[model samples]
Target chain A: MSYSDLYRNAMEKATARDAWKAETIEKITAMQSSHKKNTSVRHICFTAFRHSMVPLASAALIALMFFYSKNDFLSPSLSDSSNNTPYVAAFSANDTASIQEQTAPIGRSRSIAIFPNIVEAPTPEQALPSDSCSLDDAVVSTEQYDQAVALLEAQLMEQSQDGTLPVVLTKSDIVAQGYFSANDTISVVFALPATSMGENLYYVYEIPLI
Target chain B: MEAILSPADAVEVYGNMVFRAAFGIVKSQQDAEDIAQDVFFSLVRTNPRFSSAEHQKAWLLRCTFNRCNSYFRSAWHRHTTSLEDYHNLPFTPEETYVLDTVAKLPVKYRQVIYLHYIEGYSTAEIAQLLHRNQNTILSQLSRARTHLKTSLKGDF
Candidate 1:
């Protein structure tokens, strides 16, 4: 037989092949029913998850904002010691000057009224003499000494407006003093000290300034 | 009254087309049934939008072909007896030995032969369906014919 005749016979045989009958159709329909139900449930779950994405993101954002605001409120107290170091230095300077001026002997029986404005300036370590004197005794009254210390604290706070009191160093000054090398490229290094959290615990930060 | 077709009506219309397409590949009643059910289940789950009946038919054919290719590659195929073995069994041999031989050819050759003869699809149409160049499909069809002629020489 020719090739065309052979191909024609093949087509007839393929077309005449047995197909699925009633019983098999019933089984397949049943399988499809279960599959349809399962697929519907899966689609519902996927859609619900997709819809919840926005609200979930918003809730996370709100939580982040609350945490940041609470931290903002507590920030000043943690930083107070470092921030007020300049004021403390100025107060000590005023106290030293007051002590040197009050070195003379005083008359008895008269009550020493310490005014609120009587501030004794503190002396710097370099300016203070090593010699022992009766300067401490001259301002020995407890009430007067307390009043003088309070007034001196107020004066130092006013002097700290321009931040000229050399008590606490700024970050720029620390960098400028050659404590760290300056380069064009920024880098971050993390050092993990032995601590209670874990042996492998490490703190990491990216320093944007070189 | 306006006619409202149920999901079952949609399946009945499309299911036959899917069965024909699947039967083309598997050449078995049982395998075609499984593939048809799978195609119907996929249609229901996806709820794919089709512009017309022609589009739906094309989609079913594409899906059925994919499922049949996968089934052909599966481990079950290794365990199953060949179509040649099926011919010698108790069932009446409605299909001639020549046709059976062609059906039992490797999937690539069988597909080209089936599309060319049984489906009456042009080389371009077969190329489009198989995602091959027209020239490649024509060459494949030529090779399949030569192979079939050589195989069926003694029987003819």
Candidate 2:
């Protein structure tokens, strides 16, 4: 066969898959419409807020911290040094010490706050009553708990400005083991939601009171 | 110049051509389909104006070729590959034989041969689409034809 004949034969056969063409067109249309909608300011803002809830929360916390720090709402008595163990110091001494150790090189500004935000403690059924208990152990009403959680979340957003997304502590994610009055500390355990790339980190914080 | 055809109409007219151009170089149907989608997606996003239908087709073909080259250059594609076999193509035995022969040619020759013989694009057109000197395209086409002639001695 001549090259001309071969070209004719090959051209005749080199067609795209029928099913793929239909599927592709459908996908393109869907993407175009979604892209159109996604470009709107409201849609973009909503999508961003939905996807980066953790980051947003962290930002709010940082802003609130700046406000509190500037106004002396969070006194020096409740600073990181007042606590016997710093959160980072404790984290660095544990098995996952590397997580905190790596932060030093990143040069992120760090601060610790003792929030008096939580007005209620865990109930007796939820927490063990210690001999030094002075505050009443009561389950906070859902509304009060939510308000306190929002305040704490805002505080956390402030703490995250150093670019560390430490466990995103939210009301839903926290398990309040109750407050200890002896050292004026509130112990809480929380887990960070898995990152977009699927990394999950758990954390515990013992917030002190002035 | 403003685009002569709508995005959907352009894709309908030139999608197969774009797919074939991409498939000619990549030797992968799935990758070719992806390149076609990207070409149209870019068209919709950029809404570039073309002087005529022929200009639009050439532009689409050029984009397909560039995307295919980029796919080959990508480290991820280089490290991991799951290419579809030539025999598995939906073509008659003779057509498969021709394509398999074409696929075996060097990358430069493969593109020149496809555009020249199958797609019926002239050497000058191919060079312009690829942004190469016409002499370079002519040289690649000559080398490709010789290789095909030798590989399919009796068939040619």
Candidate 3:
């Protein structure tokens, strides 16, 4: 026989396994019911995920930035107590009205002495002294500031017309002036409108004797 | 134009053809069968629209070519397997001798020889299928024919 005839006959004789063919048929039949197979679904999902990668990363980065900035602003000042305010720690349910009363004159009487009419308040050892409020005096830690803020926030929220805290809090609104000489206490000078609509007021809080 | 073959029909009709083409290059029954399955599965997955029965056949052949190339390039196919076991292939002694001689040829020569001699693809058609110049295929075919003639001198 010729080389061509021999090659053709041999090539034609090769056959596939019967079981494999049956398995392939079964798989193809399954495809009729599942128009979208796992492989195709994976391919589509992978392509979409690939294309949206940039936007997803960008959104994550923006969220991270917001988190860090919020933390930085709200971070308690453990390093510089002299320059920090003492009144944030002085918050008490009994002193709310007195604080509001002292603060009533802020927008009108910027030069008036603060905390004059404070009721049942302990005086600090030295007002505006070089050494200021300490956590030892306030009995509050920097980590607990969130709880403190939440309490203060809720109080302010009730007085607020819209019942929402201001989005931004600046250093000008709350300040720790000094430790008073009367009772080894520190005083916080606060001046701000209760809400955006309320009048700006001034209040001095002598850090409670606790 | 003939109706396009369904996945099952295509496998039944072209499975042997694809296997032979794949085996000509890879020279392994296992690899050839795998390549054939891949070709048919791809058809089932894509369900490609073809102009005619010849178009479908050409598409399957092209897929077989690509799949064989991929198999050859894989790390698993790095070591060459012996063809001694293949001596007992399902063919007469003379036919098996011819198949073995064809399998021993280099891949490029084997590819062109199989397409030209066994599949009856013209040199021009193979050039189009393989994206090569017609003259290159013609040259490869000539060299392959000479090598086969030299190896199986008395048979030729």
Candidate 4:
């Protein structure tokens, strides 16, 4: 027989084999009935769940917005538009008082002069006495102030004797001793106290070699 | 078109159809029955309106096939013995041996053969039910015939 015919014959035999048992059919039918019941209920439940999700999410979003707005209103320091108005009024009033005090007649308070000390110059004799006092105090004290002055003076004398304080030696001093060498730079950071509004003040300074 | 089929009528008419389709793929009567029930339950739960009786029938068959395929992939299914034993039970002696033999074939070939022959589906119908191309159904059917021929050679 040809391959096609043989194939057809095999198929026919395989299919003609048997009917399913009665007990099996009954069992399947019962299962189908129960499954139908369960699926119907499950689908209804799923639909209900889906419907509720939208309202739940909306409620959550509304609650979040309400709480956030409430928090903003409660904080006295937040500086909302309304809150800043009073602060601006108080600042302007203070500015006006300060202006009055600054422009008042000099006769009202001798301390109010802008250049109070510019007209007063110490006599040469007074300058000589103050300089001697500072020098004598430095020489006689056994404190750290005396030690620092003595060290500075010794360094200056040694520098003068070396005629330019050795170029390579100055470079080394700049790197190690942080002194007044060609390459030396000084950095200073000034940290002020925190303001009442909880912000800090910072100043950074970079001083190049002279 | 008409009001939905009552759960009772659906069970009476389509239960066997669904079961056979499930059995064709799963091989075991128990798993097939379970799949059949699940399909009917899904139908009742979804309450999807059908255009005609034919559409309902096709839907059940499709659902049954899907459930059976899911059963095959389940962890429990992998550990179970071959569903060949389902037909070997002490019921319906004449047909039992034949079914047992068919069940012994690999799942891929056996499913196409059962749908084509026992379920009386056309190649195109089987392809649609299994969500396969017509060529794939044809090839599987051809392979199944070859396997059955060798298996049933002396007995037939």
Candidate 5:
């Protein structure tokens, strides 16, 4: 017999089981179902995650902004001092010890007006009550403060040139925080020791030099 | 509206051809059946578009060759093996000897012989399907015929 003839006869005797068709169909069905289930779940999760991304990022950004404004990125020195300890502000460059000493009572007042321009140059007598002042109430005009400073300067210059205000600058503890030029005179913002000035606090004695 | 032979029908039609081709190379019915199932499973899974049924047949035959070769190269095939290639087929002595001698032929030669003689593919067509040179396939077929003729003595 020929090789093909023999191979054909042998293959006829060694037939494949008919169960293979059913088995293949079953496997294909199971795989399709599993693939569909996995894909659906993964698709839904991915969709949800993509949708929520913007809102989540916005919330995180707002939270970070809040924290950043409140604590200035959590600077070590500020965090330590802000913890009910009081707000410390540096005044005179060399008078650090006294500024720190004064800082303790300033936070307790919150209305004592740490910033010189906090008031409309209100006389220390017309100073607002400790709880009545707000940092955002109204802006203090630089011109108004300068005018009040100028008035004080003229008085000091007139009295000092005639040597009538001899005790005005008798104390060696006076320190100038800042100075500015106006009207051909230097307006010096001199901080005299409260004890030397015979006053406890809240006085702006601007002296002008001729 | 529907193809005469759907992708699923490929199994029913070409299942025996793939099985027999694998059987010729591996010389085991169980392995041949496994290789056929894998080939058809790939067909059903991919559902690849073919220009013609002959294209699909050629693709299946190519997959059969790869699957059979992979079986031989598999670590499982390497480490553990059947000591005897016992067919246990109900065949006449002559048919069995012919099959045994063909099985003993190198896989390339066996593939060429089976495709040419049994599957009725020409040398050039076999070369195209196997991705081999036509002259190389012709040489292998010639050598395979000589070996079979020697193994079967004058009977071949």
Candidate 6:
């Protein structure tokens, strides 16, 4: 047979063998159905928690931003109209009171909701020292962080008038160690371990003593 | 103008075409199948609208070309494919000779050759499908034909 004919015959056979089967098409259809499924009810704040380490890394970064945030929410330059990434949302959350009002208290992040009050670019002599807060060398290791945060959690547990503090302590390490000197109190960030399986998520607390 | 195909219909109709084009580029049955799956996954994910059946075909072919490039660049594209298994297929001597010669061409040449010769796409259409310049497509086709002619003892 001719060159085109011979190649065409073999190519057709291979192509036929490799072609999509009914089962594959059904799978694609099922995938399409799932990809198109609308889950509008759940608040979509899991972008930071996409990876296990991501939450820890993000918490450390958030603590950093809380420490040194310029408090320039209204600066047209920092948050441009085009930059719509989650980073911008986080920066903007620290930048504006109104956006924090609307978006804080979102999902479990209960994450950054507490930031606006404390992290809104503090002055050197502010009543609360939110601006100086960070996961500094005080938290030399996870071991040190657990000890510091555990002490703070225990202290805060005693001070709660109602059982509002979710301080059910599991071994899951809390996030970045940040603290501030309030006029009469010392505040710290800690993890209230999930009540069941032994993974901890980030939480906040105020311990008045040293 | 034929009716535009739904994404599922497009996969059914064009899966072989996508696989063959991907095979021509990647030179592996497994890699070609993977590229085809990735192409259809994006197609299903996007559910992009097309104007006609021709548009859908062109879109699938374009997606195949793109997926082949990205997946080939990916680390999974280790060049350990053994084409000795292809010989086990029931090909006549001439067909086997043609397949081997065609596969021996450089990947770019092989791509244009299969699209132009076996799939009956014009160099212009192939250029558009492969997203290379028309001149580049023509040059590759010329070199491929010359190589095939020499390899096939002037049969091409």
Candidate with maximal DockQ: 6
Q: How many Å off is the CA of A97 in candidate 1?
A: 62
**Which tens-of-lDDT digit does each residue in A1-210 have in candidate 1?**
554465455444433433443433454444444444434433443233234443443344343323323322222212222211110111111111111111111211111111111123233221122221111011122233233333333332332344532232232221100001011111111122223422221111112110
Model 5 DockQ class? incorrect
Using DockQ as the yardstick, the better of models 2 and 4 is 2
RMSD of 3: 28.7
DockQ of 1: 0.04
Q: Is candidate 4 or candidate 5 better by TM-score?
A: 5
CA displacement after TM-score superposition, residue A79 of candidate 6 (Å): 37
lDDT of 6 at A118: 23
> Where is model 4 more than 4 Å wrong at Cα?
A1-210, B1-4, B82-94, B154-156
| Runs off by more than 4 Å, candidate 1 | A1-210, B1-24, B83-95, B153-156
Per-residue accuracy of model 5 over A1-210 as CA lDDT, tens digit each: 666577667756655454665665565444434334333433443233234443443344344334323433332322332322111121222211121112112111111112221112223223322322211111122443355445554554454456643234433443334332211122234343344534322233322111
Order of candidate numbers by lDDT, starting with the best: 3, 6, 2, 5, 4, 1
TM-score of each: 0.44, 0.50, 0.51, 0.42, 0.50, 0.53
Question: What lDDT does candidate 4 reach at residue B15?
Answer: 66
How far is each candidate from the true structure, as Cα RMSD in Å?
33.0, 20.2, 28.7, 35.3, 35.3, 19.7
Cα lDDT tens digits for candidate 6, A1-210: 678778888887777574345655776665543333211101132233333234443455554434324322212222222221111112223322222211222222222323322232222223123222221111122333344556654444443334444344333333433544221223345434344433233334433221
- Model 3 DockQ vs. reference: 0.19
Write one digit per residue (lDDT tens) for candidate 3, span B1-156: 688888888777777788788877777777787777767766755567899888898888888988887777665676765454445566788877787788878888888988897789999999987888999999999888888998888544
Number of colliding residue pairs in model 5? 0
- B1-156 per-residue lDDT for model 6 (tens digits): 688766677677788888888877776677678778767766654456787777778888778877776665645555554554567667788887888888888878988887887678898888887789999999999999899989998666
Supply candidate 4's per-residue lDDT for B10. 74
Q: Supply fnat for every model shown.
A: 0.06, 0.28, 0.52, 0.00, 0.31, 0.53
lDDT of 5: 0.53
* First chain TM-score for all predictions: 0.22, 0.27, 0.23, 0.23, 0.22, 0.24
Which tens-of-lDDT digit does each residue in B10-57 have in candidate 2? 777777788778778887777777778777766654456788877888
Q: Tens digits of per-residue lDDT for model 4 on A39-119?
A: 343344323323444344334434333432332322222213221111000011111111111221211111111111111
Off by over 4 Å in 6: A18-20, A38-210, B79-84
Query: Cα deviation of A144 in candidate 3 (Å)?
Result: 52
